[model samples]
Target: MTTSWWTFGLQTVNFLILVWLLSHFFWRPVAAVIERRRQMARDLLDQAQADRDAAAQALEEARRRSAGFEEEREKILAEAWREASEARSAALVQAEAEIATLREQSRTAIAQEEEEAARVWTARAGELALTVAARLAARLDGAAVTETFLRWLTDKIAALPADVRSTLGAAGEVEIVSAAPLEPGLQRRVGAEIGAALGASLSFSYRIEPDLIAGLELRTPHLSVRNSWRADLTQILAEINHDERI
Candidate 1:
């Protein structure tokens, strides 16, 4: 309150010096430290940003890889399903083909068996019929029957192959009925009868039978005929059957 002007000026100058010294020494260093700290903090923030960006990028890559794997899995599954379906179809087709082949084979085999059986039956029936006819014919006998039978038998025998006809035994030798002898009439001229019937040289043998109801049965290698009552009845019945057929 009692200060001079010079004292006031001096005090102002001193205050200015103090402010300058404080700024140069203590405050300036502190500001620099603060600025340095702020720069370091900024650098740390940049590094953290970069790390976060890298992490995000890695996550994206991992997502992409997962997507690729998933796509592959889906593709593989689809392919597998397709293959399985194809395989199933192929198996079904194969099975059907095999079944068809087997069925055809079975049909063929059955047809073959049937044909063979028919052939065997036909052969057996033919043989049995011939044998039965031979046995039946042996019992027949008669003069008129013998003449008719000789005519028919001669014609049939002439139709046979020469080799078979040549082997024929004498007509009289073949016994129709064992109990009776060959008729003396046929026995006397058997050679001439055979020669006339065969149109060639001939031989003969004698046989007799009574079972034919009075008739004669003649047989050659290639021909047989019963000239007897039994044959007469059979012929009549056959004629009746033929009339019925007509």
Candidate 2:
């Protein structure tokens, strides 16, 4: 190598100039651009974080509102169910009361109907008994029955009170009523017996009544004495009717 101090010194000076130029222009500009880009990236990250926080807060608020709505709906449904149950119970109670009332009414009606039926049957039995007695008594109308009744009449007249006998004797005439027509001889005997019993000689008139049913009756304007099967049957029927009423 040929040593050249002049060439070496010149080269060294040019290198120094180049180094200063690069430091002042290129390096400074590139460092400023990088710093600016880093600042912008930090600002963008801060904005994104803020937006995410706000979105999370909104989601929590929506969840709280949904829970409140669900609770309200449940409360309304429970209230409606309770009201329906109360209504059903009231209806059942009313229906039961009505059924009991109807049953009581029916029982009362049945008892009344039974009482009426018994009364009607009792009346029918009384009528049947009276009819039987009347039919049987109708067969006993005969001379023997008449003669017996005449003797009883004489006895009855003989036992009369003093005032009754006086009243009979003072009457215009005695009416002799019988179930059958008497013979003239019997009539004379009956008049004699009656007049003897009354201790008076009395005129007499005769009349026949078949309804006496085998007995005799003494009648005046104000007094009547009945001794007949028909009268006995009638009295018996009246007593039976009185007992039933009691």
- TM-score of candidate 1 relative to the true fold: 0.45
lDDT of 2 at 109: 82
Tens-digit lDDT track of model 2 for 106-161: 78787767766766766576556656755766676566777787788778877889
Considering every candidate listed, which one attains the maximal TM-score? 2
RMSD of each: 10.3, 12.3
Residues 1-246, model 1: lDDT tens digits = 457887999999999999999999989999999999999999999999999999999999999999999999999999999999999999999999999999999998997787667656554654454445556655454455566655655576567677655555433344233224556666655446656655655545556544444445556555665555556555654564456446
TM-score of each: 0.45, 0.45
Q: Model 2, 100: alpha-carbon shift in Å?
A: 16
Candidate 2 matches the true fold with a TM-score of 0.45
Reference-based lDDT, residue 157, model 2: 77
Clashing pairs in 2: none
CA lDDT of each candidate? 0.66, 0.75
Q: State each candidate's clash count.
A: 11, 0
